[model samples]
Structures are given as C-alpha cells and as structure tokens.
Target: MTELKKQISASLRKDLEAGELILPSLPEVAMKIQEEVKKKSSTAHSIAKVIMLDPGLTAHFLKVANSPLYRTQNSVQGLPEAIGLIGINSVLNMALTYTMRTMFVNTEGPWKKVLIHQWNEATELAAIVAVLADYLPNFNSDHMMVAAMLQNIGALPLINHLQHFPGLEQEEVETLVEENATKAGLALVKLWGLGKSFEDVIKARHDWMYESTPELDTTDLITIARYHYMKDKQRLEDCPPTSEIAAFRHLEELDFTAEMSMQWIDSAREKIRAIKRMLCM
Candidate 1:
C-alpha cells in the first residue's frame, strides 16, 4: 500500500475503533417514517403525511409506485395513493433508499464520478435482490433491497478520506475500498440505528459460503445479486459460474435452478433499468 493509503486506512481504523467516524445521519424524513412504521396504529395515510415533508421523496414515491416494478394499472398521482399502493413497509424502504442517495452526491473532483459509479452498482444489486426475494416464501424483499443498497456504503468515507491526498491512482483507492468497506459499512449501519440484522448483512455480504442456520438470509441474497452484477458488467474473471457459487447451492431449497437464475437476471435487467432511472432522477 502507498504511504497515503496507509495513513488514511489507519485513521479510518482509529475512528471506527473509537466510534468517532462521522457516519452519515439518516435524513429526518427517513427517521420519521421509520418511527411511524414501528407503531401498530400507523397507516398509509399517516406515513404519507410524514413523506409529504420531503417534496423530492414524495415525487420519487409517486414515480416508483407507478413504475413497472409495482405493476400498478392506475397512475398514483398523490402521496396517499402512492403509499396505499406500495404498502407502508415498502414506502418506508423506498423513502429511506431515496433519502440515502443524497449522501453519495459529491460536487467536486473525480470522486464524484466514483461515487456515481458505486451508487449505480449498489442500486442495480438492490433491484436484483428485491426481485429475487419475491420468489422466496419467507424473505422480506424490502429489507433485502435496502441492505443491498447499503452493503458498500462503507467505501464512501474511505474514498473521501483518500481524496485528501495527492498522487493516488483511482485503482489504488478502489482496491483499498474493496478491502476495508465492510468494516466501515457495518459501523456506519450501526451508527444509523438501522438494526442488528442490517449490520449482520453488511458484515456478511462478502462471505459467499455463509448460510443461516434456519435458512437463506440477506447475506445469501446479496451474494447472488452481486454475482449477477459482476456478470452483467462482463467481469467474467471476477464471477464464478452459478453452480460454483455457494449462495446458489444454498438456494436449492427455494428451487432456484440455474435456468431460473438466468431468467431472473434477464427479467431483472428491465426492472433494474427502470429502478436506476427513477432513483437517479
């Protein structure tokens, strides 16, 4: 590693150890939606009231509600209607995902481009996970989607830290991020109070062989989604065949055959395009 990278890595490790890293805060709108969803009495209308506080999120919600992913025949022209169509939990997940996008927006330097690339990959993986989750009986698609989006979030601060130094190659920075993102990501997830399951997902995402005692979980879903993302990007050397991937093997219980996996990726391509368009807007 370069001296600058060494310094940045050390600093990041120190901050993570001491709980001093300035992790991104959950947007107020997401906080409100999260709080509202936890209550038994909460309804779509109540969540819609909270969502209205953020006009951008409200607009995005409407767009997503009418997206092909939702398959809503009627246009969702209002927040209440959008929320009602998408469900309370889904609204909460979408709002949180939408709000989190702001954290990756950097205005200056090549890092902005890097952030955009990372964000794009994250969203694609999340979209695939959301679709795959639907075929599994007990999986929570919304939560899996959110977890996929966040799996690489730790790379943001690390990349930002590296930007302060001169004479560093983008490849070097990316290598550092791939090495350290999980630790930083888990810490950030805990700091955001997103829950232990999410933290586990972040920590376990790179573990292809990870299998939950009871059944498949977010880690398995993300592993498979990431493999597809790599394959879609034509990173053939980086991705193994479906049969060789542990997540695919563990997915046998869900009747996830190799042919079905291919079909899932083919179907997800369109949804991923639509989702990326909506989120990027």
Candidate 2:
C-alpha cells in the first residue's frame, strides 16, 4: 500500500484498538426484541406488545406482511393480522432488520456516498440471503439476513471520524481504510453482544473457501448475497471468481450462468424493493 494509505490504516487500527472510536449502538427496539425472542416463555402476543410500542416498527411489520414474500391470501391491515399471517419469528426478524436500517438513515459524512451505497448493497444482500434459505438446506435465513445487514457497521464510526476530522478525505488512503471496515465492524458487533453465528458470518463471508461444517451458515449466504449485488452492478471485475463462492460453484453445476445469476438478482430486487417501500412507508 501507499505511504498515506498505510498511515491511515495504522491510525484507524490504533484508535479502534485503544477504544477511542465510539461505535453506534444497536437500536433499542432491536435490543428489546432480541431479549424478548430469547425468552423461552415469550409468545407472539408478548412480542407484539413490545413491538406495538413502536408505531413505525408496527407499521413496517404490517407492510411487510402485505409484501409478496409472504403472499398472503388477503391483505394484512393491522399488526395483529400481520402477526397471524406471518409467524411471530418472521415478523420479529423483519422488525429487527428494519430498525437497524432506520438507525443509519440519518448518517452524513465524507463517506456518506460510500455508506449509502454500502447500506443499499447490504440491504439487498440481506434480502437475497434470506430468500436463499428456501434453496439452501440447514441455513438460518434470519441470522444471514441480520449478518448481511450489520457486517459493515464498523464503518459508521469511521464515517463519523472522517466527518469530524478535517485531515481525512476521500483518497486512496481512505479507500484502503474502507477495506478494513469488515474487521472494525466485527469488533463493534461483538462489543454490542451480538450472537456467535452472526459474528461467524461477518468473519468468514468473503473467504475463498466455504468452511465445511455440519450445516449451512451465514458465510454461505453472504457470499451469494454479495455476488447478487455485484451481478446487479455488472461488477464481475470487482469480485473473486465463482469458484470462490462455494454455493455459486455448485449452482454452476446446475447450469447457473452469469445471465441466470443476474436474473435471480432481478427476482431479489423485487423483494428488496417491496421491503424498502414497506419500511420507508
């Protein structure tokens, strides 16, 4: 790397390691929902009660219930109806993901352009990963969805630093520092008390070899989700080959060409678009 890049990375690493950078906290609703979900005795009615306290979240849940993903026999016009149509777990995860997305919408900085792009990419990837659970056995779509949404959260503080510090600008050095975002994000999420599965997905998602375990994991979802994003941008040059994605390599065996991949993204885009509209409204 260049001298300036090296210096920026070193400086960021030092600050991050020394706890000088303040990472953003998970949204309160997400925390509360997680707590509620973890309780073995919690029921749909109980979770809905906490969620109903947040008008925006309740609205989003109702909207998602009406989304094509669920494809209900009829429209869902209320929280109780949504909960009934889409199971408690599914609605809970959607609410949690929407809360995180809303949390970062107000961010501004030198990295705002980068951050928005990354967020959109992540949101789309999260939706894709969630849907992939239908085809990929033993995969936890909820974990993958949340992992894809949050894997780059470390960049939030980095963006704040760049905005507050006049010395930093969008240069090659800054770009390299951006690449270190994943590491910073993993650390921040751990600090926020995220589960081990999400951390594993964040850590291994971009690796060349899909770690072979007894079951499907978030890494596989992230790998495929990223590919979907790149495919949308026609950004083959920006990513590793299909061989790098364990899932993609296998899909290739089933005659999944690049064109077919983009088509899949088209399907994913509809899901993402619907979700984004539902959340925003």
Candidate 3:
C-alpha cells in the first residue's frame, strides 16, 4: 500500500475501533422497521401498519410484493398481505436494503457511477445468494440475501469521501475505496445494531477461502455466493474452482460439483433475475 492508503487505512481502523467513525445515520423509517423487527411481539399486521405510514414505502413494498418475484395465485393488495407472501424476515431485509439504496448521493456527484456500480454489484450478489440458499432447505434465503447485500457497504463511505479527492484516476480511487472499506463497514454494521452474526459476515467478506465449523453457515454461503458471482462477472482473477475453494470444501452438505454449479445457476436464473429486478426497482 502507498503511504496515503496506509495512513487512511490506519486512521479508519482507529476511528472505527474507538466508535468514533462518522457512519451515516439511518433514516427514521429504516430505524423504526429495524426496531420493530427486533421485537418478539412484532407481527405482519403491526409492521405493515408501520410501513403503511410511509405512503411511498408502502407503494414500493406493495409493488415488490406483487411483482412476479413474490407473486402468487392471489394478488397481494396491501402491506399485510405483502408481508404474508414475502415473510417478516424479508420485510426487514427490504427495509434495510432500501436504506442502503437511498444512500446514493445526488446524481451530479463525480462518484455517482462508482456508487451505482458498487450498489448494483451488491444487489446482484444478493440475488445470487437468495437463489443459492433456496437449494438448502435449512437456510433462510432472506437472511442470506441481506448478508450478501451488505458485502460492499464499506465502499459507500469511501465513495462519499472521494468527492474531495478529484484528480485521481479511477484505478487509484478503486484501490483507496477497497483498501479502507472494511473499517467503515464494520463500524456501520455495529452502528446499525444489525447483530453479531452480521458482524461476522462483514468480516468474512475479505476471507474468500475461510473455513469454519463442519456445519455450514451464513458466512460459508456468502463466500460461495461471492465466488460464483465473481466467476459469472469474469472478475475472478486468481480465484480457484469450486474444488479448490475452502468454503465449498467445508460445506460438505452441498457436495457441489462444477457441473452441478452450472445446473443450479441455470435452474435458478429466472428467480435470480426477478429478485434483481425487484431490488433494482
């Protein structure tokens, strides 16, 4: 790393560790949904009522709920029915994901393209995670989707800061953003009180080959999902095949083969596309 990168990285780490990082604040609706989701007594009706208060969000939720992705034989007419179809966990993820989506700075900013690129990449990985998790009955695809959606969150603050450093080429900007993203990401996850599990997933984003317990976990699913996403994007520079990936090796229940991987993606393509459409909307 250059001196500039080293200094920024060290400063970010220190600030985050000290709980002094200037993490972005969550909007009130996002905060309310997050708090409501944490309550044991929270229900679809109650959460729906809260969501209903925001006319715009209500419209968006209903649109997403009725979209082909979540559509069923019966149409979803309101928040309560939407929640019923999409589930409470997904409702929470939707709110959080929406929160991230709204963080995009004004369109005129120099970093707009970078922000959109990173955000779309995150959502695409999230779509992949959602579909991949569908194959394993034990995993909640909704939770995994949220985990994957947050993988690039650290880049947000880096992009925000880049507005001040304009003459740097895109490559230098990318290096700066990636090098300091983890520190910002860790602080954001904690600041948002998203739970320790999320914190673990955030840390694991950098460890593509990390392996843990014999049983599979959110982190393992994310590692595999990210690897596949990279492969699909043709961005997997030196990443090994599934046979050589630790997460793939560790998650024995998958028994994933190269051919099986391709087959799974093929079958899940529509579901994945629908999810990406919903998210991008």
Candidate 4:
C-alpha cells in the first residue's frame, strides 16, 4: 500500500477500534416512519401522514407504488393510497432507501463524482434485487432492495473522510473501501439500530462462502444481485463465478440456473429502467 493508503487505513482502524467512527444516522422523517411502523396500533393513514411531511419522499413513494414493481391496476393518487397499496413495512423501507440515498448527494467536491457513481451503481443493484425477489419465497422485494442499496454503505463515510487527504487517489480510496467496507458498514448499521437482518446482510454481503440453514437469505439475494452487477460492468475477474458462490449453490435447489437468472433479468429490463427513473438515478 502507498503512504496515503496506509494513513487512510490506519485512521479508519483507529476509529473502529476505539468505537469512535462517525457513522451516518437516518433522517428524521425516516425515523418517524420507523416509529410509526413499530406501533402496532399505527394505521396506514398515520404512516402516510409522516411520509407526507417530506414532499420528495412522498412523491417517490407514490411513483414506486405505481411502478411496475407493485403492478397496481390503477395509479396511486396520494400518500394514503400509496401506503395502503405498498404496505407500512414496504413504505418504511422505501423511505429509508430514499433518505439514505439523499445523504450521498455531495455537490461541490471531487468526491461528488465518485459518490454519484456509487449511488447509481447501488440503485441499479437495488432495482435488480427487487425484481429478482419475485422469484424467491418469503422475501419482501422492497426490503431486499433496501438491503442491496445499503450493501456498500460503509464506503460512504470512508470516502467522505478521504476528501481531507488531497494526495490520495480515487483508486486508493476505492481499494481501502474494498478491504474494509463491511467492517465499517456493520458499525454503521449497529449504531443506527437497524434490525438483525440488516446487520446479517451487511456483514456477509461480500462473503461468497456464507451459508445459512435456509440456504436462501437476504445475503444470498444480495450476493446474486452483486454478481450480476459486476458481470454487467465487466468486472467478473474481481469476483468468482456466480454459480460457485455459496448462495448460488443453495439457490440451485430451486433449479435456479445461471441461464434462468440471466433470462429473468433480461425480461425485466424495462421494469429495472422504470425503478431507476423512480429512484432519480
């Protein structure tokens, strides 16, 4: 590693070791949505009211509710209708995804370009994962999409920190992220009090060898989505063949062949495009 790389890595390590890393927190609207979701007595209208407070989130929620992902017969006309159609859990997840995405929109720095690229890649993977969830059992497409979007979230703070070091090249910062993102991400997730699912998925997202009793879990779905993203970007050499991964191995029980996976994604190209547009990517 170069001197700059060493400095970046050491600083991150010291922070992590000392539990002083400044992780990002969820937006207030997202927190309110989560609080509403947790209240067993909360009604759809109540959640809708919280969502409506943020006009941008309200618009995105309505757009996603009417998108091909939900496939509602009629367009969702308002926040209440959108909540009723998409469910409180899904609305909470969408709101979180939207809010987390806004945190990455840096406008006046060299890091802005890198942050934009990362956000686009994240949204793309998220869309693909949401579509792919339709094929799996007991999986919430919206929730999985949110998880996929957050897979590399640890990199955001690290990249933000790198802005202070002018001599560090983008490549070096990316390399550091590749090596330490999971650790940083887990810390962030824990700090935010996200559920165990978020913690598990973020912790094991990059571990191709991860296996669970059910064989098919959020981590597996994320791995598959990530594999497709890398393959589409011609970065396959950096990862193993999708079929060789533990998640893919378990998915084989469902007779999920590589060709089938590709065909499914190919068929949903238009849907994916629609989701990206709704996400403002």
Candidate 5:
C-alpha cells in the first residue's frame, strides 16, 4: 500500500508540474453569471435571464429564495424575484452552489462512490460554515459556504486516476486524498480562475494549529468548520478540543464561543438542513 501511495503521488505531482492534469472548468451558467455580475449594468432581471436557461438551476434558485434560510414575509416566486431576494453578489454563489451539486451527483467512472463521499464531505463543511458565518458581521455566509465547498477541491484531480488502480483500499484512498489535496486544489483553483478566496482556503485548510495572525479571517472560519466536520464524523478521537484551536481564539473577538457555536448550529439546524438538501438534489 505504501509503495502504491508513493507511486501514485509521484505520478500526480509529475502531471501537475507538467500541466498535464485535466481540471474541471466552471459550469457554463456559473461562468456566465460571473461575467454578467462584473458588469455595472447588471440587474436582478438580467441575472434572472441567465439563470432561466437551466431549468434545474432556475428551480433551485427559486427554492433557495423560498427556503427558510432566505425567505421572509413573501415567498419568492420567479427568477428575477429570487435574485432580488438573495442579492446580486450571492447570485454567482447560488449558481456555483447548484452546479457543484450537479457535478458531484452526475459524476461517472469507477470512483463514483468515493467521489460522492468527497462531495458530501465538502458540501457538509460548507453548510456548517454558512451557519457559523451568521455569527460574524463582516463575513458573507454564502461566500463562506462556497469557500468550504472548495477547501478540499484538491482531492478532485486524483479521483480520475484512482479509478484505474486495482484493489485500492478505502484507507489508502483516504491517505492519498490527505497527501495531495492542497497541491491539487491549488492547480485546479488557478486553472478555473476562482480567485484569491479559493487560493487562501486551499492553502490553509490543513493548518490544524495555524497561528499566522491574531485577527480572524476566512481561513480561520473554514478551519473551525473543518474541525467540526472531523468531530461530527467521530474522527477527532485523537484531536484536541475546539477551544484549543487557534481559530477559536480569534472567534472569541467576534463574541463567538464553543458554547455559542453549538447553540447557533442547533438554532439554525433547519437552514443548514435546507442547504444540504438543495446541494445534494
């Protein structure tokens, strides 16, 4: 197993350095939405026109606009209205949110089951952070949601090659995922033109005891989310408590605490559940 791990790791790094690895392009809808958003002339109605092209995305947009997470006195009814309810900045995030789920669900090849696990893990982390972001005034929850989803995106480039390996154990697969995720993620994020937020998330996702700055950042939030993700899976048997995490200390300046974290998660259970359902569907 160790030999296979080394062999696979070496091959992947060679391909990465040589720019031979195939990375996924952002979905057309997401790309189009991003372009449209950069235009100072863009409006909810115009954004609606772009989203209306995909029936699935259109439906998901409406559902999100009406979900307990965003809905208020009036239920969102149409694409333009949905875009209005969520704000233009979040429309691209919404488009991304839908397409990522679609990509994960609609995957092909021998590693379908393994890929699905990765999909669920990433999105679940996204959901946790989105809810947690509600506690902070400066951060955007939708943006944080997307950041968490992409934190482990490094694992994606390897899934294709892993399918070719015979008798790869689950433990071996998990090990390889940990070994190459950050490097592979950086390559994909750059290729896709995902920008700085993604670069930061991939770079810091594994810094379990990171202490770079006393100030809180998007990286710190995802770190906290990653810890929660591990804890929820009972994978923290050997890990330290949340209070010990450097990120948690910064969170205190935001009036967030280990106790507040649990309470907020519990209070916003419906919103998180809604997001998970939307992403998986």
Candidate 6:
C-alpha cells in the first residue's frame, strides 16, 4: 500500500479501537423486522403486516414494485399486493435497503452529499447485480441483492464521526473516511449479530474470492456492486486492484464476456431512471 493509504488505515484502526466512530442505531423498524424474522415462529405474512404500518416504507415498496424494472401483474395498491409481486425475501431486502437510505439522508454538509452519492451508486449497482444474479447459475440473487445494497454501510458512521471532529482537513479526513467506513462497516455487521456469511461478504468485498463458502454467486454480485459504485467516481474511485475484482473480471472464464457486461451497465442505467421517476429522485 502507499504511505498515505497505510497511514489512513493505521489511523482508522486506532480510531475504531478508541470507539470514535459514530455508528447509527439501526432503524427501529429494521430492528423489529430482523427480530421478527429471527423468531422461527414468524411467518412472512406476520413480518409483512408489521412493515405495512410504516406509510413511507409502504409507499416506497409499492413504488418499487411498479417500477419498470419489475414486470408485475398490475399496479400494486397495498402491502400484500406489493409483497406478492416481489416475494417475501425481496420485500424484506427492499425494506432494509429503504431504511438504510433514510438513515443516510439524516446526515448533513459535504459528508451528507458524499454519502448520498455513495448510496445512490450502491443502489444502482445492487439493482444490476440483482438482475444479473437472476441469470447466473447457482446464485441466490435475493441475498446478493440485499448484501450489495448494504455493502457501503460501514462508511456512514465514519462520516458521522468526521463531522463531529472538526480538526481534520478535507482531503486527509476523506482518506480516514474510506478506511474507517470499511472497518466500521465490518465492525457493525459483527456488532449487529448478522449471519457469519453476511459478515464475510461485507468484509471480503475486496477479496479475490468468496471466503465465506456460501457460493461464488453472492461474491460476484458484491464485486459488480462495488465496481459500479467506483465507476461513478463521485463518491469513490476506480475499482480497487484486488483479488475480488479479478475474480469478477474472469467472467470471460464463464460464458459471459466484457461485451455482455455492457448489458448490465445499460440495464442499470435504465433502472435508475425508472426508480428516479417513480420516487422523484
């Protein structure tokens, strides 16, 4: 690593060790839904019932269902209709994604804009990952979709902390932001008691291969998700020179090639437009 990257990483480790990062309390509804899902007794319908109570969430869910990205039977008028259109797992993922988006909106200043751009990039890549995962053999697109949606969550608390600490220069602070976001995100997944597999996906996002052993599918989704985020060049940078991306780059080893990748890129653009139109983004 370059001296600057090493310095930033070391500093982030110290700050994280000192507990200076200001990780957000998980959204209440997301917590509730997670708790309900963990209750082996809870049915999808039960979870769906609770989610319907949040009008903003409910409206967003319906809007997502009606988006041109999803070919639905018809316009969804209610929570059940929306859930039916997208399936239980998809609804769950969408709820979590939407909740995360709301939290990012609560930040202010340059960091707020930076994080918003990151979230938007993540969402776009996630949508493409979701679409491609559907076609990739042995892939669980649902898990991939949710994981991709949340991969950058580590950055939020780091930015929050930067805002609270006024002494750092903008450029220097941004380096810390990247390092801590990765570290804090990994820490939050562990602190929040997510599945080991989920934790592995978040932590190994830049790795060359999926170390969690679930399947290479979800890792591929994360790979592309991060790639698209980096491609935006506003919130982040060009894709990291890491083994994880190289693994994704070897898609030509599969039936797919560089040319085919463009389809995903194009589809993601269209999906973003459709979502923006629906949500007035």
- Quick one: best TM-score, which candidate? 4
Alpha-carbon local distance difference test for all models: 0.76, 0.68, 0.76, 0.80, 0.81, 0.66
Report the lDDT tens digits of candidate 3 across residue range 194-237: 88778878787768666655667888888877887888888778
Q: Which stretches of candidate 4 lie over 4 Å from their true place?
A: 106-108, 212-214
Clashes of 5: 1
Model 5 RMSD in angstroms:
2.0
For residues 8-106, write the lDDT of model 2, one tens digit per residue.
Answer: 677878877787777777778777887887888877788888888888788777776777666678777867767777676665568666766675678
Q: Write the per-residue lDDT of candidate 1 for residues 1-281, one digit (tens) a residue.
A: 78877877687778778877666677788889889988999988888888889887888788878886676666778888888878877776787678668777643565666667778888888878877887777887667778898887887776666667657778767766777788879887877788877877787766756565446677787888888778778886876677776678778767677568668778767776776676662
Off by over 4 Å in 6: 1-11, 18-20, 39-45, 140-142, 206-215, 228-246, 249-254, 275-281
Clashing pairs in 3: none
State TM-scores per candidate: 0.90, 0.82, 0.88, 0.94, 0.91, 0.79
Tell me the tens digit of each residue's lDDT in model 5 across 1-281. Answer: 67887788788788878888777788888889989998999999998898888999999889888875686897778788888889998988788778778877776776677778888888788888988888877988878888888876776777766768866776787777777778788888897787877788888867777755678888888898888778778898756777778888898887778778878777887878777886664
Q: What is the per-residue lDDT of model 4 for residues 33-119, given as tens digits with 9 covering 90 to 100?
A: 888899999988988888888898888888888887786667788788888888876877888777777787743466666767767
Order of all candidates by TM-score, from best down to worst?
4, 5, 1, 3, 2, 6
**lDDT (0-100) at residue 121 of candidate 2?**
66
- Model with the higher TM-score, candidate 1 or 3: 1
Consecutive 10-residue window with the lowest summed lDDT within model 4? 106-115
What shift in Å separates residue 116 of candidate 3 from its native position after superposition? 0.9
Look at candidate 5 and tell me the lDDT of residue 65.
85
Where is model 2 poorest over a 10-residue stretch in terms of lDDT?
A: 208-217
Candidate 4: lDDT over CA atoms? 0.80
